[model samples]
Target: MVKEAGLGAMEKPNHKHVADSDLISPAKKAKKSEEAGCDTEDPKIPSGAEDEKQEISGGEEAIAAVGDRAAEEESSSCVSEEKKGFLIEAAAAEDRGGRQTMEDVWVVLPDASLDFPGKLRCAHFAIYDGHGGRLAAEYAKKHLHLNVLTAGLPRELMDVKVAKKAILEGGWKDGATAVCVWIVDQKVFVANIGDAKAVLARSSSASELGNHTEASCNPLKAIVLTREHKAIYPQERSRIQKSGGAVSSNGRLQGRLEVSRAFGDRQFKKFGVTATPDIHAFELTERENFMILGCDGLWEVFGTSDAVGFVQKLLKEGLSVSTISRRLVKEAAKERHCKDNCTAIVIVFKRE
Candidate 1:
């Protein structure tokens, strides 16, 4: 099990845009697409086809040989340390809807040398899911890290309890969900506002399971690092109600915003909606392998354990990080059939 800590907050400028509540009707359910299956065939060949088949096979082999050589050269040139102290792989994939731009923005800063007093090297990763428009998501992607870094380092922003106070004080507009992960040495810090999520996939320890066997294979466990802030959550709904924000019959914030927390949405700020994030800090163990940060579009269709299992299966097949991430986004888009944009980032921690 993953241990969780307190929360934090950040602010962003606001913008005017239609919240997701406007796009989706509460009464309607999205249709799930059927899984496609592959078809295979073995056709009979004539006696004279042997020579022709050999000629075609030789040509195909030659082409494949050239392609392999090119791939090898390209891979070598592209390999580099993403950050000064860590060897990491990161990738993002997005699928947009017809009317709107992909309202998903992600960031991967492998090495952010802060101006802190000590030898502090922080690697930051985040995903922002924009609701009304791309402005909030884009803005958060660019500024959220800076704000967190400023609060965490030079200013010593260590008090997590003050997150709510900061959000109430900050002025922000349009709304967007945010999930962030900051790595300093072996410690990992995570924060989230709204439904965007962060999950860690690692090997389960024998003690955690309370059982052990020498021949048993250790199972992989999915650790949800962030809590989703939506009206559906009891606490969130109560907070909204107390703040004069009504949870509509359709389960929206004042029948406008679907999420209960976000970076912008100045309109909902007074109604109890907040930009405060649930923050957690923990040390990364050798058993930990990778972490995933994704927008709700992915989570809507794939559960935490399901997503982790899918990625782990792909990793065991020797798939690269980028390929795994892109596949996940595509899978979510196809499965969810949701009108919302989809985005995901996969970060693999290499053994030093």
Candidate 2:
């Protein structure tokens, strides 16, 4: 695991637009549209599309009707995406008895060439490690991308340091930990917030496909961003004790909670940098292949390097990427009969 000194307190992202609660209503949509300028209902204007109407004479009645229709379309589109490869797999076996809910999110961006060229076209991947509850993990999955985008495109490429700064200052939860990876230009930028890890698995040789036995896969030179917030690191322990907390017999703090850097644990924020994410960025080499973004659930079963190897074997055996991810959780639960939720996300990088 990577280790580092405290980077100090990170400012929370602005939630001025997001309401205190979760529920979203259709009426809210119409009001927003009306504010944006949807006045006229000209036939020549595109139907079922957002049109800039010059003037709308109708009052609440017309706005409500238009908004209701838009809301229905939006809801339908959401359901369709959920049905696709956007998989949310959870083996309830573990979550039943533990504090971990195993709520994680993953998004795969399709390779588009307008932005970059060459073999660099790659998929984006992320994994959030939540503890104390699934709130942090869930929050990270939902907002980590917005943090990166807001961080300002890292200029010619993704800057992990800048992204991490954005995350810390970007308004993610107080104790949540996150790891995100995306491809920019011809290079791969991987950033971590807490303990969640990202690893690249490379195939031995596709050109010599005829001779390789079982297709060897190895962990490529990679970067670890989010460091574990634990007592093993002297500085972390110091930060914890200084902040009025004590180390536990289990090597974790206070009988629970590992790693000192997290996004949303308000309790730990009093200790300063002990509660922020450590962001690291690195460019990948040709040997760098598929990458894995997983939580402590999978790590509980496999080492960072070993997990990558297991995934490689699964792929060689013709297991689908999603299947391998699900199996990672399944096998982990089966091995230890764990009550901690097991979750994982795997990204397979292919040449374009």
Candidate 3:
């Protein structure tokens, strides 16, 4: 049997409290990253910044401080902590017997931003889908934030693609799809891989908006995140078949690669199938309400709109993200009629 990621109950604080125990200064939260037990490391900075390194104490302290000030400035400058009204909740459940030893992993980035006081103006979130095993998913969970926080990614991800190519060509196991969202320069960029999905909800009614707007129904729009690498998409399927791999049931080449793009799965390269992620970047209006990061287990059962609706209802009833995550998994387990491991992280975005 595969060793599961343990089932110990996650600690959550009551939502009604002003002082949540989970609430810690951003610096302390960053330090906890090193202790998350997944060999997940701190965000990497650019080379030749030795002068900046000297400005700080230990290397670990430098990393712990990277995004700490960002959180504070955003709080004192943009929003007030007392009026801050957004919540992020996450949950994971594991079942050992199904689908390659249950290697799926999920994480919620530290809630340092809760310090922002204005009407919860920004939300950052991510979802990773693991394949071939859970290592790739776990790797992304640990590294995605660091990558974003890291000083210099080529503005176009040209370096990201180049590095990925080098890693795969050298025969690395990069088989997870990642979808990440962060608010910068007043717009939202959602980047993705594999089939893991990120969804946005727009208020549909004045009632839904808590009387914030006069519009009768707020619209829910899907801000597309990562593109899939399965062979089923016509262009991708054609590429696989043309490359000499057989397209099997449902138009997927080789019957197994359901997505047209992915982060790992090196064996597919023989047919010239490269494990590259298709990143989608876009802006969402400030009215955007909520976002969800879930594995295919949820997608296999819920439509994009259906999920947004379900979560919106839950939030209206005063549920936290952690509660939402648990319910989503429970719902999937029920619908699938199996002991499938399900994990989810949800971010509820609100106006201050």
Candidate 4:
């Protein structure tokens, strides 16, 4: 029975603002990395200089849901252990580091059952990094997920059209990069833009976090789930040049913004910055131990494998999920001297 990360209710604001989605992208909303003062390309981004906005934004709502973790941990229902084992626990943490403003926002939705009224099990997590400003990041942290819900998220399968449409309809301003995850039953869907990234800790063999000896034999494998959209990539460069934008030698759009895609920056909209997200869906299996979502600042100091190993060691030592996330931020800001806002989310699959 693991403690789940449910920061609070997925409360929508009273205001009807028909706008926003960041922290991640596609043509849906290319969340440009803004936290590293650039795009997710920097970790120093979501990549480049302070002039380059690096924003990580995350907002999640449950279009569907199953049961909560506390209930599962305390229940004696007929649900088999194998079925119960798929329930998830999550947590998030943040650090400002040396940045003048903290521009990363994130959300955790353990079960959307209360809002959606469903028997299906679902969970969501997201993170955002803002570059020029934090407004864009903050906005996405509240509305993007709700928009996805309203757009009709498919329960049995991921309707790319439906999901992508949700993001497309989600209007945004300013700039930020996003990374998000939605879990429905055993299916996992990941959506992202910029440098904010999602990584999965997988194992070739069943390795209990409680058993280091066994865990060592079946070391967790780090699998990066998001792709960074910067001005330097050939694909992005092609688009930028076609859009009449130039990628300077330093690898920034117009010698100013480094991320080729973003939520806002209407100024760059004509130049190639977009907010569309790259979405992926896959099955969750016993081989997956946990997942991680982080803004560029955190990645600036931690490699995917290094982060997985660190979290695995701590899980074996029985550290709290919140603590693990906090440590990730603190380590990046204090120990590794990351120069931007650091934010992270940790989601662990129940193995019991």
Candidate 5:
């Protein structure tokens, strides 16, 4: 069985007090790219070894300090464009959580704007899974995309590490996991922090099979795009130990948070927790089918291959992307009995 970090009990704080300033001016929040001394010309960020050392503090002051450091190390990049021929779809279902079944947030931008006049004929999908409270996730859902757009599309999209750093520095008091995918031209870019994940379905022989018959068609394979930042991972465990944080015998950060990296979580910043994201780029081909982004709630119940194969089976039956997404969440909640809030976004690339 796949071991995942459990969402422990946490007190909900005032959302307005936590994220009001960051959400009001989405453009302004993103514009900080300039103030951070980020270069608009080059978007490729240097490797992790060069990450700046941040000072430890408390409350809002710590958040401000991290933001200041993130700005100085930030960079941007752009992507080429081709005619768009894709169908995008997304849906999410929530498990009961007291007064609300909320805590999960997603964004879909089929016609996202680029630095130039004509919009980039690409699509962007993201999922933010909040822990403790919804303020950080809710704030990221509203402003992270805008920040990506403001820093310049395509180019900045590839610089997800810097973008995530910016979001963390944006004054969030809680923490949340994030996973996002950007489809541009014939390439797909994926970036993620913490455990929320993105998976791609690819089939080299898909074009050869004309019909949906299972026997005649090539099987779709799951390609996990992002690595989970859990304490069980050796590198993550080492990093926490070096930073004076302890990993429990059950594999949790300081025997508290399950994830080693996340947005917000001001309390854990001093213990080596970060918001840096892992970014990967893939060239699109005829074999490509679709992609899925979901929180740990879904992954805990389904492995990467299991989820991808289920979606492929549904596609063979000619089910729509929207229907597949809704069914995925429902199954996880009901059939698998996922205890946490669940959400998923599916983007299908139609072959013509």
Candidate 6:
């Protein structure tokens, strides 16, 4: 069973993009594309191709329409550390913020072994930030992971494309940015498309074993585990131009969408928007502390450094992962005054 152990608050959005008088408060928590094309038609990825793939190097052709390189089915780099037996814990949080509808959806499956049968022992976490409507977000939350499970749960990198392709199959005019993580024993796999981000906090030698004081917190490094995929990026812009797509003065694809890679943006697929995720994998060590998975709303006001420091401080104060996640969401929505729906998940790899 997927032990949603410390699940704080996760709600089912009405799945709309309109206002509601029943908008919930922060104290209570909960949860939750485009286009067509002319030149490059919609992607026709088969459902059972998870096995016949090679790990594509990052930044070469992560965009689906950019090349024919198939993504691998496992983490490219994973060193065994199962002997460490790190205690992993996770929690979730969300807020409507200034938005009428909550368009962010997330899931935490602490035991993904059932989904993969007799394969690797795995745990999964994901966040999807939706636009145009909450349908894409809701649909992706419910079905994307299932689709991935059906196709063998993706190696490490190619999972988001499966998610985006499944969401687009419904011919919906919505889109979503995805950030997902998988923990298989001591190995960590981070995958993302669009702007939703995953940040890992690594403690220094002193911070890992020292007292949870300000001095111990100062040495923590916030390592961003995923790349932002927006049209403004040089490589992304070049691909969009080559695909016969145009970026406006404001850096949006065809003067509409900002992210050059996402799910369910069929209209922008030919415009160089892709579903391929940049997957990163590594083995966890003692220096690793925790991870934060959040949408752009939280990121808009919370820098990676700011967030890591904030969480570390709260942890020193003896806050649980569940409370820390809720506080993080409130910090982004209330204190930071983010005008968009905010959601976050904090996963602690080894809690001392």
Top candidate (TM-score): 4
lDDT order of candidates, top first: 6, 4, 5, 1, 3, 2
Q: Rate the local accuracy (lDDT) of all candidates.
A: 0.53, 0.41, 0.41, 0.59, 0.54, 0.59
**Superior candidate under TM-score, 2 versus 3:** 3
What are the per-model numbers of colliding residue pairs?
Answer: 6, 16, 23, 64, 5, 11
Residue-wise C-alpha lDDT for candidate 1, range 1-352, written one tens digit per residue: 1111111122221111234424421111111211221112111111121111111000000000000000000010011134333466666666542223445566666665444443544677867676544455555554555654544432233332332222222222234677777776556666677777887766554232211121024445667776777776798899888998888777778777777776655656688866656556555555566788887767777877788777877776677787787678667765556455666788876544
Q: TM-score for model 4?
A: 0.73
Q: Model 1, residue 197: what's the lDDT?
A: 80
TM-score of each: 0.68, 0.58, 0.59, 0.73, 0.70, 0.71
Model 2 bad stretches (over 4 Å): 1-123, 155-168, 202-214, 217-226, 241-245, 248-256
RMSD to native, candidate 4: 11.2
* lDDT preference between candidates 3 and 6, better one: 6
lDDT of 5 by residue, 1-352 (tens): 1111122233333121123222211111211211222222222212221111211110111111101000111011112223545444444334432223345556666655534443345566777776545556656666666655554554323443443343334332235677776665555666677777777666656563223345125556666667777766898889888989888786766666677777666566688776666556556666566777887777878777678777777878887665677667667767887765666776766644
TM-score comparison, 3 vs 4, better candidate: 4
lDDT of 4 by residue, 14-96 (tens): 11011123222212243432221111211111111111122223222111000101111101101111234565767777666
Candidate 6 lDDT over 1-352, as tens digits, reads: 1122221233344222112433211111112123322112222212221111212123211221100001111001112112245667788877767765566667787776554564445677877776654445555565555554554544344343443333233221234677777775566767677777888776656346324454344646777777787888897899899999998787777877777886655666677767666666656777677888998888888988788888888888887787788788888887888887777888876634
Task: Supply candidate 4's per-residue lDDT for 350.
Answer: 67
Q: Judged by lDDT relative to the true structure, which candidate is superior, 2 or 6?
A: 6
Write one digit per residue (lDDT tens) for candidate 3, span 1-352.
1122331221221111012222211111211121111112222212222111111010110011101000000000011111233323333333321332344454444332343333223344555554433445445555555543442322232333332222222211244555555543234445454556666555533244432233223435443343444566666677777788876665544654555555444445566455443333333334556566665556666666676666666665666555565566556655554333344566655544
What is the Cα-based lDDT of residue 26 in candidate 6?
A: 18
